[model samples]
Target: MSLLGDDSTESVAETVQETREVVQEEAPPKTGSTSFKLARLLFGGVLAFMAVDNFRNLEETVGYAESKGAPMAETTVPAITGSLLFGGLGIALWKLPRLAAGAVATFFVGITPVMHDFWTIDDEEQKQQQMIHFLKNLALLGGALAFLRVGEDD
Candidate 1:
């Protein structure tokens, strides 16, 4: 007449209770405020937008590279690749943030030298601009990493 067998019922109940306790125990503590969440969302949104913008300007980017003395084929190819890559990365940050942040930080570190190379610029003003761009990217990378850490707490 008893369902789940008399012995199995007690064991099943115990298992259910244990599972609930474990779930509660492992649940993440609420550490982030509403403002922190909003800031994170804004940071992520801006990065996503920039990615789309970069993709939209692929052709103009190629032209800029050509003007900078890059080979025609090489310039165009990298522009397209970078556009697609950054756009994909932006989407990733929006969807799977931890992975995206890690990838972006790694990418920024890897490209920092080429991005900030003072020797590549002939004009003083251009060199200053490049430095500014380099610092901005570094800041963005830092912000992304910080966002990832904050997200993990949420």
Candidate 2:
């Protein structure tokens, strides 16, 4: 069966294979630029460092998340930390970078609202702190998105 609707003669498998070949043929030459590599390492290294901190303070992290009304905090804390660590490593090593960028983006998006609900906080100081964190996360999200578009020339 063809996925392109009626009147399509090509099967899905054939179409996919052809698309893959075209992509491979059109892929840009690897630049291996030192500055770009350094930037990736810096971005990914920060994530990995954060993951390490989370791992070291798993219980405290979970408690904080629970206080923020995160459901299943105990399980979620570790899962999130693991994602950060692995994603950071992948991006740093320039291995499957796009996928790693997605993972990093997902982590920030998932954590921001849950952990920094400034509107819900009544204390002025705490609210300000949360708002700052929220804004920082938004900036980080932008960086991750830019990373996702790193090699679109292909």
Candidate 2 residue-wise lDDT, 1-154, digit = tens? 5466655554666898999999888746343888878888998898889899999988899999999889899998899889889888877887877888888899999999999999999999999999999999898788788777773431
Q: Best candidate, lDDT-wise?
A: 2
Per-prediction tally of clashes: 0, 0
lDDT of every model, 2 decimals:
0.62, 0.85
Model 2 TM-score, 2 decimals: 0.77
Deviation (Å) of 114 in candidate 1: 2.2
lDDT of 1 at 88: 38
- Candidate 2: list runs displaced more than 4 Å: 1-31, 151-154
TM-score of 1: 0.57
Off by over 4 Å in 1: 1-32, 63-94, 151-154
